[model samples]
Target: MAHQFSLAYLTVQGCPPPEQIEIAARTGYDFVSLRPIYMGLPGEPNYALAENKELLRQTRKALADTGIKLLDIELARIHDGVDVKKYLPAMEVAAELGGRHVLSSIWTSDRALYTEKFAELCDLAKPLGLTVELEFVPIASVRTLAGALDVLRSVNRENAGLMIDAHHFHRAQDKPEELDAVPRTWFHFVHLCDAPAQIPTDREEMTRILREARLYCGEGGIDIAAIVSRIPAVPFSIELPNLARVKELGYEGHARRCLETAKAYLAAHPRPQAICCA
Candidate 1:
């Protein structure tokens, strides 16, 4: 199958649902990634799995109308644990909306518990034909590549895998060799972004890093081209949170620039030649 690319919805947090869909479609993105937390504030009215049936219906209709696939549902925070009951419903929603995977992250102190919870969640997801992707965040318990791999080993399920985010990879200062250590098959999804070397001092600083400082694929100082060349081919998603600036330039203009930057990066370093042919 051809590799698919997506623009994550977190980049356009302030926009309405229809505008988000339109932006992804206009940008030449084949898929759209949704983060449930981005739907609304914690206590405010929002699309929780059980209560948001109409909103979910609208989102599905929006994708159908716009021709942009809902590639995945990102559970940005898993504070209490995996919450199998909550997650199972979300998996149903993902399947109903045509999403192939569910992206999630857990707190650092919860890692041990998550190891067990994740395995149970995987068993629940398998029957539904869904894959659970664990994203390692800089602030999360599974911050480093080593920590992520350990969790994967603990889960030990065929459908459980990692979501490699370039930003987090750099933030965690992951060693190059760690990439080779992971069985390429363990990665189910990848999120792409670039940032400068300066470290953040606070949450606001980190937010700015995500929204303002992120460079387009090849334009940044990060060795993203080299990194992408090493990893196995998967469904890569461009997550330029700073691209919200594109709204001022218009959606098509913003998307064109993102795609052009990505193309330039890929051309500079083609995929690494396989050591052995299949």
Candidate 2:
């Protein structure tokens, strides 16, 4: 079987509602991931939960028109102390919109509390038929692959898994062996983007590079080839943070470049046959 890939549009934070589907379709992406459908703004009133329903409807119609799918939804900003209720509705909407997965982050200052909360969230998500994928961020509570694996183990739910971001893998200084250690069944989603060789000292600066300057798969210094070779089969989502460049080149041009680069990288290092899940 051939590997499946998707393109995430979080690079365009303020992307006009009308253009979202257009961009995804024009880019030849298999699916699009949206953030607002799962996570809401921190400390602000939780109006987005109600406000997002219509947006979800529009997004679904847009996908229908463009022939693209909404693969996943990310709740990236909901901090540790926030109520999980604030995000569950978004998860429901994501399911309603035909998304297969919901992404989240561990944001608590207390590691133990955060772990417990994450496990609880996983339990909550199980009955909804949604997979809770924890994405490890360098500045968040679970800052490394090992940290994510620990949380997943604590959760101990079949629906819980990891969403590996290439930037975080490199930022955490994880080795290829770390990738090899991930259980094939627990690898749920993959985010692809590449950064420069020189690591940044400042967190904000580092985030900017991850969001904006990342090159396509084989165009940069990241060891994506080796990482992809070890993982079980999962949808690879390209999330380059260069919206301005994308706008300049137009969707087709930008997507073709990204896809070609990824194909070249995968060609150079073929993945082993994935272990089938029940």
Candidate 3:
């Protein structure tokens, strides 16, 4: 069977969940990811779908009308001053909208504490039939596959797994072949995008690179075909959040380009190297 692809929330950050669902379906994506929680700086748009009943109703209707599934709801952070329990309302809303996973990250310096919080979040999600995927970013505390695996091992939550981002993996200087050592079940899905081989040495610059600039699959330096081949069989979320390009092409056009480029890459690579994992 072919892998199901998603139109990630970042690809059209300004769109509300309902609009995103419609765009995803029109662009031929099998699933769509939502960003109900605000992760960026203030002054940005946040749909806050959990608190908006009417919006959720509209989003659910969009899903039903389009037959597009909800891939995940982002994002929960394991940092200070933010209560994980506060995410429950949003999680509940996402669940109601047919979301099956939640994207999360840890930023604090404290590892053990964050692991506990992640496990607790998993506990809360189990009843809702949702899994928590910890995505590793260059600026995030869990910055590499090794770091992400360590936290997953520490938490030991069946509902928690690591979400590999191709940009982050390349920036971390990790080889795709290294995924052979990773447990297959640890990966529920992955964020697929490409970037230049010249990675930023500064964390702030790296953050900017991830948030504002990313290339569509097969467009930049990342060996996306090799990376996807080495990783376990899982769906790919097209997370190319190129803000400038969105301004040039508009939301629907940009989304169509993303889906088209991803499909082109996949079609080019008909066979993938098998990964051995237990």
Candidate 4:
């Protein structure tokens, strides 16, 4: 496999959906994560592809022409005043775009309610052939690999899995050995990046560090190799959001460097056998 990496939208969140696909292809990435939903938060980019027929057509065309696959679609948050029903349109579009995963987060502290609501979303995504990845962040209720695993087992939906990021993994003090307790099928994909060995104490600070200051695959102190060795054979998303570096090299250059560095790492430390690009 010559190309087996995905360019995460957050890596270059400054770019539009269509351009993300084009840049991914130009930078030698195998897949691109699509953002077609309003994050329901201020300052986040929103693409109304669900209703924009022409825009959706263009995005689809970009993917088809570039041969860069649609790895996932995102920000289906299970938070206050957010209805799971609203994800239906994006889910429909994502399935049409050949996306297999829905990136989501859990905001409520109510474990039972979160489980039921998450399972409901999974039910909606089931027939559409899209799985729900409940991303665990240090700022959220599902904060650890163990917490995420608990939620997955509680929901127990076939189309539901855990989405782990190395930054959060270390923030929660989760060890690579902890991967043993997680079922192999419980992972749909993994978010890959590295960060400083020193962690911040403030929640907002931690959040900013994760979204704005992530280092490349091996540039930081996090053991990306050990963490990756545990994730099941699956397509990995390069989600380095180094804003300063982006300002220095631009999106295309940053993406190319990230891909090259990641490919070298993967070559040296190959994942478990049977892994294939998505």
Report, for all candidates in order, the number of backbone clashes: 1, 0, 0, 0
**C-alpha lDDT values of all predictions:** 0.71, 0.72, 0.86, 0.84
How far in Å is the alpha carbon of 176 misplaced in model 2?
A: 1.5
lDDT of 4 by residue, 10-117 (tens): 899768878999999998888998778877556876686898898899999999999999989888888765579999999999999999999988888888778888
What TM-score does structure 3 among the candidates reach?
A: 0.96
Estimate TM-scores for all models.
Answer: 0.85, 0.87, 0.96, 0.94
Predicted candidate 4, C-alpha RMSD: 2.7
- RMSD after CA superposition, every candidate: 3.1, 3.3, 1.4, 2.7
Per-residue lDDT tens digits of candidate 1, residues 5-41?
Answer: 7877555544545566777787777887776544355
Which scores better on lDDT, 3 or 4?
3
Off by over 4 Å in 3: none
Which candidate would rank higher by lDDT, 1 or 3? 3
Residue 13, model 2: lDDT of 47
**Candidate 3 steric clashes:** 0
Which has the better lDDT: candidate 2, or candidate 3?
Answer: 3
lDDT digits (tens) for residues 21-121 of candidate 2: 66767756678777654233343223243365666567778878988877787773436566676677777777777788888888776767777777777
